[model samples]
Target: MNSKIQNDIKELVEEQVISKEIAASIENYYKSKKGDTPNRLFTVFAVLGSTLVGLGIILILAHNWDSFSRSIKTVFAFTPLIIGQLIVGYTIIKKKNITWREASGVFLFFAVGSSIALVSQIYNIPGNFSSYMLTWVLLCAPLIYLLKSNALAILHIVFVTSYACSFGYFNGNNTPWMYLVLLAVMMPYYYQLLKNKKIHNITSIFNWLIPLSAVIVLGTFVKKSEELGFLMYVILFGLLYNIGKIPFFDNQKLRRNGYLILGSLGTIYMLLLTSFEWLWKDILRHEIIINSQEFYVSVVLLLVTLGVLIFSYSKKRIQNFNLFQYVFVMFTIIFFLGVSGSIISIILINLLTLILGVMAIKIGADKFHFGILNYGLLIITALIVCRFFDTNMSFVLRGLLFVSVGVGFFLTNYMMLKKQKGKIE
Candidate 1:
């Protein structure tokens, strides 16, 4: 039962808007529906408690390592894993509710990692951290489904992101292709979370984590023609934005719609940063290998983004996409326009920035939302700040430009608030 609804019911009855009997009946109905749902706070603490226990156990065993015999060390190494398994087994067999399942699953997840490390250390296993991370991730992947644990799912995303960094960035490896496969395997669970529509907080966390993990690991896919990865990132953000606009997520609040937030911000960041002449100059000067892995990856991402947009159009998820959604498509055209066209592309980028900023302001004003309105101002401010370094305009001129924008911010927000306040009155 939602506490907000319950409070409203209680107040209604007290105010004679609803009879006491009707309030009791409403409360009973809701309690019957949601009584089994675990308290979200308890769920968080349970997972945290299990994590601390797992860490404390590891610390205790490490403290006595020198004194233990080989057999004792082996036993100690497996102890936590065994205990975690028992707890999980009990939960499954007894059909324990979400709290126990989450706690046990989290404990087992850490236990698996700890056990792997301890055995490797004791037996002198020769493997890099990347390999260990991969092994741990593969081993713990099953626990996510077995325990039906969102906490474990979140942990899986974190580890896979770490694995991508370890392998792709530090290991002299090119692309961690397995990262995609690992990421793909988790999608079904995410889909189920959305389909169920219960435990919204967990669903929201996954929403945020999934895109954020992709954003973090995206750089790992970049190789030669590495500048092309910027194009790939914008398309990826476009895809995320499109997905966020799908019916299920489109109805949610901006705070809950992680894909849209990340996509919008990411598109802005990439577009602004690439608005510089230096990047365009570098692109023109460099020899981009058409056959490079990065090039192919960019192509794949573009195709997929286009495909998603088409699907969205067919489904009527959006009658029209925001200007931010088109950035990726426009960026590609500019990306290919090399040579002396760099100047033209730079001009186009600046225009796109200005147009997007203006559009945001208009949308914010129309929606009468202070957040959206301020976000538009923020974009314009960022653009001006970027121009601060890139232009030869005199200090006095730039100062005036900044001052004008500052005044626009104040006036726009002031007018919006006045409108809102008058409407309220």
Candidate 2:
């Protein structure tokens, strides 16, 4: 058991709420539970070792590749693929070991890539990096189910996203619709992993990769209307933030909660950037259309976001009034105000930031959470820094503002800590 639980149990015993024997039994059960869990080191090394072996084999073959005949090179290319397939197939049919499954899946994954790369090099095949990644990821995707491997699933997500970036952003492809198809193909396996609760470290991988893929691929869906893109992002962030609020992901680590982190950061950053007059001026120059593909996408996302919001509201899942929980409403108002040429939008944006900072401080103080308190202070400091960049602000005034905010930070933190200490005593 962790220290907190151990202390609680000890207190229970002292209060005569439970006997010492019961506390000892609970501790022994936790000890046995810890012993029963698998060592993650083996799983880590399995993936690492298989990857290195695959790379080493490729390097060794490459060294003598120039001397080999076409037939020999072809044989060499297919050998790893054949061997990997056999290993994976055998692991699927007979092996129940997670380490074995992961090691074999990873080995086979690289083997397929190497085999394809070597064959392409030998035959002088013409293909882009995006197509290559797409092919590799699709081929490896089945291993997630066949081997039941979360490690391979993580790798698959990384490559699939890399393919989207390569195809859409780097290649500037006009028809990037294939990315959506491929992304959809991978979702079933992700859901399977979620259903089985097999994810551990892989959860962090998903948290980072999914948001990154969305950021990369969402641009591909934009056709003519760029302004609608902002609306799309607002809905997107709202959806992500709500997903993170779901019960399964609610209590995970900060990094593991990518939806909340990315959504909140994206919303705040977009709001801050939009607070400037030039952005609104540019938007006013365009003929705002309500019938574009971007518009449809935005509307669809908005509806989904609203659905989640309503569901969350009904469930009382959003007890805390964090910035992420309410930025969608704030952004919608700000957008309308900006379009109408009202200075009130900018004022509202600034006010929203200040309110968020103050709320964070209040919540942090109530919970005795130093991170939340610092985050609130950081938001205020960020606003001050943003103000310093404006040509309209005098250097002297900016300096005074910074000094004043700095003093507030110090005093507020000092007072909170004093209060917390007093409570402890």
Candidate 3:
């Protein structure tokens, strides 16, 4: 009797015949609810709105160009900038709800500033481009603080960096001090972005841009001599090493990608430096231009060396001594030894490459599959074989050297790969 009553209850429930209204209520109760959809439409509208406003401003400027006197045009250029400052000031004071109007106003300010600078140049105004750029950046800097405007702040930073790279780099006026100043200027805004945790995308953009700019500007001053260039690489890699030591759990993507990009590029650059004979040849053949005092170079080198030592000691991690850092320090010490002019440095360099290449392959094989270190080893092996088998050598000897190096490379790499597979299995 109990089984029969239970079966009947199951049949009734499965039929869903507890009246149409109750059945509908039960279905609704179990149905999953969805939250609001993403606002892609707003994003599209914002992009379109900015484009139209930019075009409208350009059109107005074009139409007025012929009729307006030079002074009037100049006044017109600054008028937008002045208005932008007022709008930003008002936004700061009121702390009102953000609206499209305020955003558009800030965007216009950027457009107006750029237009003024560009138009002034087009008319061949007798003003310096650097000075104008400096002024514009200074004016925009306060907007970042006063209105808490990330967009304006980033725009200013990018413009300043671009200007510095163009003028300072090409003109041979770039200095470490200049890079330090630019970094300083951007630091406060960087701090604010971190504190608020807003505008993360913008913050990421500046983080990459600022460091890259520093590298480019600093590189110009660094390439004065082979020794100095080697010193610069040491500093560059030291910076990379410090960056890699950051706690990865906080931002794995940023930390890993940053190290990879900077380290890879720095390594390739140092490799090219190692391979080229021009740097050493130039130093040996000609008197080095000593426009600056030796103290300058010594000071820069000391600071970079101290930075590396401090970080290495503080971290106490073996991995901190990466390929770039090791090569940089080795090159610096070798160059300072006054033996770079000898033919022996070439042999020594090649030998170093072979050893490091083998070590890299061995270490990488332990961590990753596919013998990832084979590429570096292959490059070094090729260089050694080519150097030993040049036309200056007898044919039989050249053939033997090539075969020996080639066989060694194949055997070592194959063993590494085989060991990796065994571990994985």
For this target, which candidate reaches the highest TM-score against the unseen true structure? 1
TM-scores, all candidates, are 0.94, 0.86, 0.68
Candidate 2: stretches off by over 4 Å = 1-36, 192-201, 253-255, 283-285, 320-323, 340-343
lDDT of 1 by residue, 64-102 (tens): 899988788888889999999999999999999999999
lDDT of 2 at 221: 73
Distance from true position, residue 137, model 2, in Å?
1.5
Going through the candidates in order, what is the number of backbone clashes in each? 0, 0, 0
Q: Candidate 3 on 1-425: residue-level lDDT in tens?
A: 24564455456668974655664554444442212322445544653566476567667887767788877777766665666556555655677433433364455556666666756755886766565766667655665555555556656667777667655665555443443565587788777665665334555665566556656655555545435555565456546544544443114443323443564456544654555455556553334445653326645755765575566667764344445445656655555543335665555565656666666665566655343466566656656554664337887877887787678778777887687679789
The candidate with the higher lDDT, 2 or 3, is 2
The ten-residue window of minimal lDDT in model 1 covers 334-343
Please give me the total number of clashing residue pairs in predicted model 3.
Answer: 0
Model 3, residue 339: distance off in Å is 6.9
lDDT of each: 0.87, 0.79, 0.57
Ranking by lDDT: 1, 2, 3
lDDT of 2 by residue, 193-219 (tens): 566653466656777787767866787
